[model samples]
Target: MSTTSLGASAPSRAGADGTGAATGPLRARRRWSGARLAPYLFVLPALALFAAFRLYPIGWSFVLSLYHTDGMAQTWAGLDNYQRLVDDPLFWKALGNTALILVVQVPVMLALALGLSVALNSALLRWKPVFRLGFFLPVVTGLVTYGLLMGALLNQDSGAVNWLLQLVGLPEVHWLGEPFWARISIVLALTWHYTGYNAVIYLARLQGIPAEHYEAAAVDGAGPWRRFWHVTLPGLRPALVLTVVLSTIGTLQLFDEPFIMTGGGPDNATTTIGVYLYQTGFRYFDFGYASAIGYALVLIIAVFGIVQVKFAKEED
Candidate 1:
């Protein structure tokens, strides 16, 4: 009887221990569920704001594009506004100007940025932080302020730029007054303002590159230029792709510089799509047509963005 009672007590104790172990984990899991939900709850407000402000505005713009409006009256116009866009010569001119800037300025800016970044990353360079800050300062400056400064500097007669040209025995060319020079000035201003921003991005990416890769290249007797071509260039592919796409989008949306400096012409030479869109919607009071132009710009950006992403993936 003693032996049987002892065996029975042992089984009872084991059963109690097993039940407690399982219950403890089950309670812990319940607590974890609440913890996991807390992150989602924290993000809910931000998601709601994005949906209301960004997503809703985009959807409403599309809807508004399908209707003719004069601010006081609205009527369903279907595809008429898009058709008008097709026939508008000014629209094409603006698009061409935007395309020209994108083609010419983006590559030049990115190239300069890459070169500056590489130079800054070199061990030979000193005062790196100061140089980086000085280069990036223009990006933080107000766009209108930059535009005003550019306009004053590039003025045809009494401008500092003309004074320098005359000092160097070069003829003083019309900077903002002539069509060709106006376009060139816009490109120069854009490059000055944004190159440092791209350079900073490249610098950040360059820092993440492993030291071992460069050491390995050196072991194989690769010189600076060779290593840069083979390793640094390949490593910077992702940054290059990002900067190119961003530059493309920015150039297409060119406005403030042209509007504030050239006022869209000596002969509409610098009139970008953004300036034209503003003139159409606000100046001409053609809200429906303006919405159509906005959508067209969106399409252009989407197409270019997709192409850039695909090109980058293929290179990878």
Candidate 2:
């Protein structure tokens, strides 16, 4: 009886050991798999949120563009919305005004930014911090707040700008009233807001440039103008390209200032594509046409961006 019992216990112990040996690798593999998948599991929620909020809306807007939405019912419109865009005078006017800004405001603002960056970076400049802060202060202001402030200042009656002009024996110009002067006010306001932001961008790029390049240029008997042309300009090419694309995009999408300051007013002189899109969708409940406008704006931005990048590369 004792011998049989000993023999039975030894087999049970052997079976238990064999089972642990086989399961150990499987358990280890499961642990390693969990470790490998941990990062993806952690990031899954963020990816989901992005798809739900950002990607889904963009995709839906494109789908919505193909239908006529009149705030009550969505009717199948095919490409009629796009066809309407071709014949729309207000759309053309908005496009023309946008083109004017791209041609005028963007170049002028970028030039001012470049100059401000150079001046601020120079050793001869005193009170660098003060100047830098002053120049960059506008960029920190909220869009709505700045727009209201500018609206107040550019008011035809009882405005500080007109008051100053009156003091100087100049006529109180109708800034936001007349079409020509209204456009001028927009250009000025845009320049005032974005120049410093671009300057800061340029300043950061300027800091990234090596001092050795400047020194080498100087040692090679390159004057300030020559050095600037050969070294500084070349060094700044990347920043210039960046600013061009960004400023173009920003100028194209100008809604707030024009909306708040001019109300796209004085015969739609200041109406940009962005403002037009807003007026179409929200004000008139023409969602389909507005979506088409949005897509058109996107296409225009893409074309200009590609062209600008290619031109910048060709310069290299």
lDDT of 2 by residue, 1-316 (tens): 9999999999999999999998999999999999999999999999999999999988888887899997889999999999999999999999999899789998899999999999999989999989999999999999999999999998989789999999999999999999999999999999999899999989988888899998998999999999889988888999999999988988888899999999898899999999999999999999889999999999999999999999988989
lDDT of 1 by residue, 179-244 (tens): 999999999999999999999999999999999999999999999899999999989988898898
Displacement of residue 58 (Cα, Å) in model 1 is 1.5
Candidate 2 Cα RMSD (Å)? 2.1
TM-score of each: 0.86, 0.93
lDDT of each candidate versus the true structure: 0.94, 0.93
Worst 10 residues of 1 by lDDT: 244-253
Q: State, as a TM-score between 0 and 1, how close model 2 is to the true structure.
A: 0.93
**Candidate 2: which stretches are off by over 4 Å?**
1-18
Q: Over all chains combined, what TM-score does candidate 1 have?
A: 0.86
Task: Count clashing residue pairs per candidate.
Answer: 0, 0
Give residue 267's error in model 2 in angstroms: 0.8
Error of 2 at 188 (Å): 0.7
> Which residue pairs show collisions in model 1?
none
